[model samples]
Target: MSDIIRRDPRAEWIARNRLHPLHAAMQPVQHSWMGPNGVIRKNVHGVGFIGPNGIKRIDRSGAQQGGAAKRTAAVEVQLPLHQVAAPAFYINVVPDMVGGRLSSHDRDLLGLARQLAGSDGAVLAVVFGEHKENAFATAGVDRLLVLDGHEFDGYSPEQRVQGLRAVDNQFNPRHWLLPDSRSGGGELGRRFAASLKERPATRVWQIKGDECIGRAGAGQEDLARPLPRLILAAVECADPVSETRHEVLPLELSTALARSLPRIEDLGAVAVDPAAIPMAEAEFIFSGGNGVKDWALFHQTAASLGATEGASRVAVDDGFMARDRQVGASGTWVTARVYVAVGISGAIQHLQGIGACDKVVAINLDPGCDMIKRADLSVIGESAAILQALIVAVEAYRNGAKRDAA
Candidate 1:
């Protein structure tokens, strides 16, 4: 056998998996152990090889030493910490957190806030009610303010605006940024701006020095103007802060918010059919591919899960799905919150299409496929069997929900 060591995807995956039960046991045995002086002793010479990229990568997984178990490392880089002890000013952001988490649009808005905040200024996130987000540190939040009260809950825009007004009175942020999307940000930002009697720059996508550029005329043209204190930014405003972690310091309103009579009534959410939802707008998508042998089973599984149906380019070309249902570079570029691929091999175009997706779940027979690699979670199994199991699970969950409600 050739002496050149090869990459082990499965081993690397397991090694990186903190939740894996066998992860600790799979660690590589170093050449040197601990000394009597309570210090770690390692081979001073070297323990890894230099690759073609001219970088030294440590492969602790014993593949190089003919051992079945080893850990592979390519100099894992930790993000630098960005801190502000005493903020000179605040950059307020209201994210369109649809499912109580930071969406990609929210991250991009935070990145914009970071750029505006620069060195001395701080990014203050204004959240209303309860949220399940825990990655605000990595998402570039310097300060976090949660207006958690029953009055601010539900579709109470007046109450939310009152909370923002309170934040405005206290922090007096230099600039207020919010996502200009349908997920509450757009309306809330507009309402806040109107309440403050400030003309906010809407549909803003880029920040060029002292000016802002936004798409106008139904996104057919660009409109440039002086930067406003309040801005309703579009997606891709700026690349999200990736090279640094920030302190998410908690903050509260020093004074109680002034209550106002609500004009809009809270009637709660209404359920809609998934099939009517567009691919680009769908939060959860169940997509099928060529590997899917039973088309009926795929459709049934999608319906059981109440997910919008999608298909790979091959499936669309083969007439198994409509052209509008195709997902790829050649088709619709989806940004679904949850994208589940059933039997897709993960073509480059397909990967590019789902690049903005928050979570990807791949179910395929081939473990080494590109889709499996890109997926945050993967299930390697027969498509027909997996679909059947999924349907059963979904039914059980639905029945349980009904019983509890009853």
Candidate 2:
């Protein structure tokens, strides 16, 4: 054997091609090993063994891979803690928290509140009722206040205003920030402002120094005015807090809330069909494309997931779905919180349609598909199998939730 090193270009090419039959064999066996810091590292994919039929079988735990140092059991990220022992002032934020989780709009509002809070001031998030959110610290909330009561549940804006009033009397926040959207925030902010007899800056997109900029008169003009005590901020007002984590100290109102006589009667939620919800307004959209072989299964999956049905241009052109269900640059532009693409190749137009979506999930057999590139989560598998698994998972989740509630 010569001491000189010789590189094989063909072997290198084969190793680079993950889809190639000889790709895994040509690659170096890197399973698990201890890092420089003595932390165990594992290659999760390297743990799988060849089955009797030559099919690769992956162990969900990846214990075998842990021995190869390919995957870390848990990647713990420790962000700098922003502590406010005593606050000079307070910037109160009311998040929509749709689906019991922090929406992008809510995070943006909190970001704006953090800007106002500064170093001395603290960002206090006021959540109504019970929420499933557990990331208040990461969302830039220095304090967390939950107003949970049967009286404050449902469509009791008046009671909510009273609660806010009690909060106002206790903390007297320097500024109040709320999301200026249709999902309960805009209405609540306006009502709260009325109760306080203070004019709120509505539709605010930018806030600087002593000036706030917002949209006015059907969004045809820019309205710049002096910063008010209450602000109803629009989406993307500021980038969400990503650098540091806050203390998220729990706080309670020292004073009792004054119960208001309800002029509005409490009416329970009305059931509506997911299909009736427009793609633009739908929070979750399940979209299919030309690669979808079982259209019936696609529809069933969407129905099971409780997501609005949408289709790529190819699927629409093929007459597998309604023209109104098409989602692309040519169709309706969606702003869904979660957009699931099934068997979609991700055309430029299709990608453009879902550009405003917060999270994109791609399900396709082809690992190199364009949709996979744009997706936040990608599962390379048969669409049918994935959809079926999703259905089963959703059912299990619902059952578990019911059991917990019971």
Candidate 3:
């Protein structure tokens, strides 16, 4: 008879670590939650659900078929210290869909490692489920923890909290970063923080650091900790040039910020000199689009006009322009005296942001495009070539004006 195979001691230890302790030595986490009353209340030693501002509910009064709306809110999740063993970063990977096939969600989360590996020491990334190995490899992360089980698959409100508790026991990360999405990603972070003793700041849109402080609940003092470990959600948008813009920008932002905290003006994360909503004071504006392919000509057109250079989302996404120059639905909404659309197709999304402009001129090869229909003056021809001609005409007109002024 073959000798009974003795199980390896190491294998038994590994299996044991995977299972819950036979006797529950329950230690609860303490944190705060923004209750339904719109006030910060304590939720001690419970699951964390980091929520953004606003209430989500069904609108039965609306006649429109779609009765859903996305609301924005403040970040107000907190937690206690004892509940957590170490700091953790919550990482959620969402797949992109093109022609019914799964693709990367703009490769946004690839900067996970760099973003977390700051002065705070070793940070952990906890993924929701399975993804391609290469999905994280680009972020310079070698091994990623995949939290997949019967419980994690069904991620309802109650399930998310339980799963997070289980995860907290396993791999504790110093911080949590998720996408600013409608999913329970933010909520889970809030809930998890509530279960801890120390409070974690919520939201990514407004970075709550020494420079900018967060407003805690009523009666709660502005508790300042050494850049209190954060829980955040981020989104990656379209780049004008390629599919690789979002993946690259985050890494750059994270690295730069880590080296030196970026000021509000230089980083472009916060608003700067936003135009008056109804009527902007500016008399002239020069705009460029993704079609203004060559940057040289784009800048030349703006220089000749002596107008501020504005960019479309496409241009900003490609890293050619900064977020401050972006003018679109997701970027800046400007209402200037004269708005020029150079090589712009005038997509509805772009038009909505600038429709308030007084006088609009469109220069493009295709007059059939939507931008031509909306423009007060349509210059038909290639943007670069036509702009060259217009530059001389404008220069002469300006010279005539200057002589008259004299």
Best by lDDT: 1
lDDT tens string, model 1, 21-134? 555445553344332222243332245534222455565546556552333343455657889999999999999887889998899899899999999999999998899999
How does each model score on lDDT?
Answer: 0.84, 0.83, 0.48
Ten-residue segment with the worst summed lDDT in candidate 1?
36-45
Best by TM-score: 1
The residue-level lDDT of candidate 1 at 127 comes to 91
> What TM-score do all the candidates reach, one by one?
0.81, 0.75, 0.32
Report how far residue 403 has shifted in candidate 2, in Å.
Answer: 11
Kindly provide the TM-score of model 1 when superposed on the true structure, using C-alpha atoms: 0.81
Model 3 C-alpha lDDT per residue in residues 1-406, reported as the tens digit of each score: 8899977775556434413331112211225433222334332212333322122222232223322121113232322121122324433232221222222222333343234443233323345444443333333232344444433343344544555555555445445454433344556656666776556554332233332233345425443334454444333221111111112111111111112222222222343233332223344677788678678877776777667777778877888777777776677666565788887877656776674465689888875566776798999887768877878898899999999999
Where is the poorest 10-residue window by lDDT in model 3?
249-258
